[model samples]
Target chain A: MRTAEALRMAVEALRVNRLRSMLTMLGVIIGVLSVVILVAIGTGAKNAVEKEIAGLGSNIILVVPGQVGLGAAPTQSRLDLSDVAYVRRVVGDPSKVTVAVNSGEPVRVGRVEVFATLTGTDENMPHVFDRPLRRGRYLTGTDVDTRRRVVILGSEVAAKLFGDVDPIGRQVTIAGVRFRVIGVYETVGSTFGVARDQEVHLPVTTAQRLIGLPRINGIAVGASGPDEIEPLRQRVVAALAARYPDETFSAVTQTQLLGTIGTVLGMLTGVLAAIAGISLLVGGVGVSNIMLVSVRERTKEIGLRKALGARGRDILGQFLIEAVLLTTIGGVIGILTGVGGALLIQAVSPVPASITWWSIVLAFGVSAAVGVFFGVAPARRAARLDPVVALRTD
Target chain B: MSHDERAGRRDDERAEASAEPGAAGAPAFEAIGLTRSYRLDGGVQVDALRGADLRIGQGEFAAIVGPSGSGKSTLMHLLGCLDRPTSGTLLVNGVDVATLDDARLADLRNRTIGFVFQSFHLLPRTSALDNVALPLVYRGAPRAVRRERARAALEAVGLGHRLTHRPSQMSGGEQQRVAIARALVGDPRVLLADEPTGNLDSRNGEEVMGLLERLNEGGVAVVLVTHDADVAARARRQIRVRDGRIERDT
Candidate 1:
């Protein structure tokens, strides 16, 4: 049969049973919709993590003290001061290292006293973290050497302490020791649940003296280029391994952390998508069932045509085309609904969601394949009918 | 001329026409010792067509008349290339049907035979024009040519004004006329109709019989299978079958 005639007949068949056809297509719609929405959510999470990772300088590495073994309780062992000095000397770059000791202390300004995390480091710390002073100068090496009692407050801490007044030359008390506020840094939003703009900073010697610590707790390192990070980490780990033979210390690269997070998120997305794929399988089965019923209903028609000289392939093509058209239309609707659903969620919730072009193409292709795959048995049945018996049937 | 002489002269002319194609004058159809049997539920073999020998010449209008279950329908099916005889050398238009594959048989049917069923067998959703155009479509005629030929066939059947009507919307007589148009559209060598007027009233039946008479007059070989003696009386010749065998030919 000609393509035009086949298509016309298929369309007529679908029109004659509109309600049943629509009901059959519903399964496909739900299946494609679920796949699209699930994939969109997965894509959104990946984007959010990537953005967060980008916010923290891609080359930045954190070397925290104490080996928190995988699934073990957290332990605190102060970093050796000599080790920090040795790292600075071995790296031959004073501008890249930020040796810092953090103390959780309560500081009072006027009437309100807020508990804030205080880190003491030299001026290079801000550059290493990609953080710059917004108002006044950052803490200097001179302050660190003299153990000056001058403090630099974060944007949020400054706001809580002085409200509308300039805190550049104000006085604050940390653990009952009076300190003069030198400057306030600009806001840096939350990363990994820790808000950078909510902390206070002082000179390294000042924090050590005030907190009664002989050595810093950790050191933050920054490489000049992202390509150098892994090599630098290896070098640092080897150096630390030699110096701290008794205490186990490790160096982790930013790439390793990013990879770990990506793997975890990818696994989660795969699980959700697999559950959604089951609906698609059910939809395919529904299509097969509908096609089987259609073949049964049109048995006489098939017989008549065959007796009139229609080839078996012609009949098969007609039914297959009908099935494919139905599923393709269903796929298009499902894609639109899935994208719309994702947009609705993004509009109402904090969770970000997005639809990718690949998802649309993939869903449509799968649905079409499902239609053809399921349509084969019925088409074959129709083709194999005996014309004489069929013509005799009422 | 006398009736016998006239018949003899026509037979000679038919023989001469058949001789021009090949040394062996090909019979339009030939069944030699054809037999068919069906095994009933009780393990008894019931013969549908047994040792049936028949031959039909080209451009011959013949009728096969019988009561129900007399195997006339089975003979029609075998003659129309719609079924394979269980055991026989059944040849249609010089080709042995038993040796031909399914596809070749379908091709032969499309090229050499057209059938009109008793129930009119029109696709319910199709327009009269589309129903008539179907045979041409199977023949792979171009769309414009198919439409023109279908229109001409509908006009031939006097259904030009009802081209847009579907089978359900049309009267029984009109639907049968459309079926006739569909059968004629392919210009087959033989037109096989089974109980062409079975579903119509007497007046409509007469009209259909008149149409068949007019087609036969145009030199198209027409075969009608009917139990109605009055319907069979209109034919120039009739063959009566009883219990899977031809009881009379006149």
Candidate 2:
């Protein structure tokens, strides 16, 4: 029989049992939908992270003491203030380099106490980190040069310590030492669930003196351009290596951070998509089971068609086409629902979700392939049925 | 029948005659010592047909009558090429069944034979027109041509106006007529009816019998299987089967 004729016959057969056909296709629908939706959410999260990292500025390098990466063991900080000056000299721009020494401290403002991350840095904090002050003056060269007891409050920290009150001139006690707030930072949102808004910054010299720690945690440097970032990172690493030849340092550019993050996120998305594909496989099995039942129910019809001169291959083509039609239709419906669900998530929630065209195409292709893979057994069974026995069935 | 119906039947016969190879002297079917057997699940073998010889000619109306389990249906199946005999030479339309593969045998069945079953075997949810067009679908006929042929065939069985009626919506007699129309739509030389009127009331049975007789008069050979003696008496030839053998042929 011609393929078109077989298709028409299959359409007729499926239409005869419309409810059963729809129910059979539900498994594939759910499978494809979950696959598309999950992959979309994963891809969206990956894109969001990439955007967030990019937002931090590209022409920068982050240098942390000790080797920090996969499989690296924790080590004590050997970095000191001299390393910062060395890096400054290496970069040839002292204004573009800064160092941060961080400690968690409880701050008291008229008995309104809150725990906040206290990071101490030089006067070039805003220039190096690209932070803008909302009020008052940022730390000047004189503050760090003289170890002045002055602090800059993050937006959240300002709100907590002095709610509705102008906090620029307010005095807050940190680590049992009183410091006047000289600046309030404009709000910078959280990255990777770590809030930047709840931090208070002071001059590194005053923080070292107040906390009794003379060592810094990490260094931040702003490169003049994207092209200088990599070479500048290597120079800083070499300079630090020269200062502490026995200790290791990690100098990482923003692009390297983004690439590592992208690879991990890509693998995570693929794994999630694969896990969702199992349900699709189960759905294909459902299709096969339903096809078997349909074949059994239509045994007499098979006999009649055979008697009417339908060849074995003709019967096979008929049932196989029917199965494929069932799944392809389900796949189309799934793609629509998955796209809608992803967009709905994007609209209503903070959990990022965006559909990818490849996921849609892949879901569709797998659903159809599921049909072909699972359809063969039942179709072959129908083809191999003896007409005499089938016709004998009531 | 009207004069026009007679002329149309004669035209069909002439078309079939010209299309057939060796048409002048070929018997519709010739079976010699045809035997068939079935193996039970526990390795018991039972003979369904034991060396039955039969010859049916063109334009002849015949009945094979036997009690249940006497293998009359088996004989009908073999004659219709729906089953192969275990150890006999069977010829359908002058071609030996033994020489043809499954596909060629199916093609031969398509071109030369039609079947009407006891249950009327019309697709329950399909329109009469589509059910009749099914055979031509296998024949690879174009849609328009299949529809036109199906319409003509249904009209021949006096059902042209009921083309769109499904089998469930039709009476038993009408469904059987639809089956007959489907059988004839392919323009086969032989029509095989297995208890064609068995499911209908006596009035409807008589109507179906009259219809089959009229179709036979149109130069198509007709073979029927029945247990009813009165039905068998109407045929031009009667073959009695018992113990998987033809006990009498007259």
Error of 2 at B197 (Å): 1.6
Stretches of candidate 2 off by over 4 Å are A2-4, B1-25
Worst 10 residues of 2 chain A by lDDT: A188-197
Model 2, span B1-250: residue lDDT tens: 4435544654685577457665667898898999999899999998999999999999999999999999999999999888988999998877788988888777777878999999998888789999999998887777777899999999988998999999989999999999999999998999999998899999989988999999999999999999999889989999999989999999
Candidate 1 chain A weakest ten by summed lDDT: A66-75
lDDT of 1 at A60: 79
Residue-level error in angstroms, candidate 2, position A353: 1.5
lDDT score of residue A233 within candidate 2: 87
For model 1, how does the per-residue alpha-carbon lDDT over A177-219 read when each residue is reduced to its tens digit? 9999888888876665666777889988889888887878777
DockQ of 2: 0.66
